[model samples]
Target: MTKKICWAAAIYPILGLLGGLYYRELTKAEHFAGDTQLSIVHTRLLALGTLVFLIVLVLDKVFTLSATRSFAPFFWVYHAGMLVHGTLTVLGRESGAAIAGIRKPADAKA
Candidate 1:
């Protein structure tokens, strides 16, 4: 389980690279408009992904969560949620749709 956590943490750099690419694209665009969603994607991938992985690492080291059977399923489910949410965010950003009807009230009016 520790090995799995380490392997999963390895993905942080890749996500960071993707975020950097998104930032560059945002900067190069002629208009700063309609880039909010893209920025959200970049921020979510970098912040959530990295922070979650780090927390997992700390928890595993401090609490030995990897040794428990119950934790295995929870770990997978958490990561799966992250992947699903990240994919949906990217798609929603591209299509300008609210993901799972989750949007601010102001956004709904627009």
Candidate 2:
């Protein structure tokens, strides 16, 4: 799979889950589920995360950027590359925690 898709597969679910949890926390909708309205801020944050990830995916293919290699000759590009990498890492972690919530139950025996 392309890097962007691979990365998004890993990232989007996490964003979804975090968005869910953050929604839950901010709204405390559990006690009264239908009473709480969805927060626009939460939606915006997740969208921003997705947008940043897409940018990273595009850069991965379009540029000669490396996550590790420093390019003092092209300081701006290097800095931008690093920022994208960092954003992806954070999104991936958030996604992971979110995924944990949706996993099937584990059983040792029938």
lDDT of each: 0.59, 0.43
Off by over 4 Å in 2: 1-5, 26-41, 68-110
The numbered model that scores best in TM-score is 1
Least lDDT summed over 10 consecutive residues: which range in candidate 2?
77-86
Best by lDDT: 1
Q: Which regions of candidate 1 deviate over 4 angstroms? A: 19-38, 68-110
lDDT of 2 at 79: 24
State the lDDT of candidate 1 residue by residue for 54-101, as single tens digits: 788899999998888898787665434434444444444333333333
- 10 residues in a row with least lDDT, candidate 1: 92-101
Candidate 2 lDDT by residue in tens digits, 54-103: 66556656774435356324323322332333233333322233333333
